[model samples]
Target: MTLGFTALVTAIVGEVAGTMSLRKATTGSKAWFVAVAGSYVFAFSMLSVSLAQGLPLGLAYGIWAAAGVALTAILSKVLFEEPLTPVMGAGIALIVGGVLLIQVGSAY
Candidate 1:
């Protein structure tokens, strides 16, 4: 895989982790706040690295945001016992489809 793609994946992972940590922080675990801050910083840093490696901003950001949202939703369902309704699943699918369009369009 390309360096930019690798960095984008790392960014997505960091963003999802940071969001999960935010959920924990909201539940009164103050220690998770530190993780939230650190994860977000790392996520943005990796996003910048992806851009520096010649990844277009629109494509990179679209994929990163879409993947982060979808993964976070699924992980939250599994880890926190949160609801994952059909409507939410459809929304995630739409987001993924939109990101795919952006990726394909960028190829031309």
Candidate 2:
């Protein structure tokens, strides 16, 4: 895979990890704060790398944000007993669809 795509993937993973760690930190674990901070920094750094490598801002950010929201919601439901209602699932689907549209539009 291209470096830009790889960096974007890393950014998505880092953002998701950071979000998950934030939940732990808020639940009274100070150590998790470190993970949260580090993860966010890494995520943004990778995102910048992707942009520098010629990924359009709109497409890259759209995919990253949509993936982050979807992944975080699913992971939270599994790890923290968070609710994953059908309505929320539908919202996620819409977000993914929108991002896909943005990606396709960017091609033309």
Candidate 3:
């Protein structure tokens, strides 16, 4: 993959990690608090780098937000045994489709 794409992926992963840590941090864990803060800082830094590398901000942010939401939901189900009802599944599908649309629209 291209460097910019790799950076965007890194940013998304960091965002997901930060969001996941938010749950544990809220329970008063100092270590988790550090993780949460660090993850977010890393994520934003990478996002900025991706933008600097010529990834369009609108497309990058749309993909980042959608992928983060979808992946976080799936990870929550796997890691925390959270529910993955049909409705939620449909919503995730919609998010993925929307991201795809954004990418396609940007290409033209």
Candidate 4:
């Protein structure tokens, strides 16, 4: 895969990990803070790589935001037993649709 693609994937992973760690940290655990910091470090490095790889800033940012929001919502529901109402689900679907449109535009 291209560097930009790799960076994007890495960024997503880091973001997910970071968010999870933060939730864990809320339980008064110092170790989880380490996880939080590490995840952010990895995320920032990957974002820098994505930008340096010449991916359009708007495209890269849009994908990052969309992926982060969707992943966080899904994971929160799964990991924390957070209830997902119909309205929230529909909003997520719309965000996913918008992400698809952005990607299609980038491909051309």
lDDT of each residue in 10-65, candidate 3, tens digit only: 99999999999997787667689899999999999999989999999989999899
Q: What ranking of all candidate models by lDDT puts the best one first?
A: 2, 1, 3, 4
Candidate achieving the largest lDDT: 2
Clashing pairs in 1: none
Candidate 4 residue 20 C-alpha distance from true site, Å: 0.8
- The sequence of per-residue lDDT tens digits that candidate 4 reaches over residues 30-69 is 7899999999899988988999999887788878888888
lDDT of 2 by residue, 5-64 (tens): 899999999999999999999997799999999999999999999999999999999999
- Predict model 1's lDDT versus the native: 0.95
Name the candidate, 2 or 3, with the larger TM-score value: 2
lDDT of 1 at 89: 99
Give me the runs in candidate 4 sitting further than 4 Å from their true place: 103-108
Candidate lDDT (C-alpha), each = 0.95, 0.96, 0.92, 0.87
The TM-score between candidate 4 and the true structure equals: 0.87
Q: Point out where model 1 deviates above 4 Å.
A: none
- In the predicted model 4, the residue pairs found to clash are none
Residue-pair clashes per prediction, in order, are 0, 0, 0, 0
Q: Over the full model, what C-alpha lDDT does candidate 2 score relative to the true structure? A: 0.96
Residue 65 miss distance in model 3 (angstroms): 0.6
Worst 10 residues of 4 by lDDT: 55-64
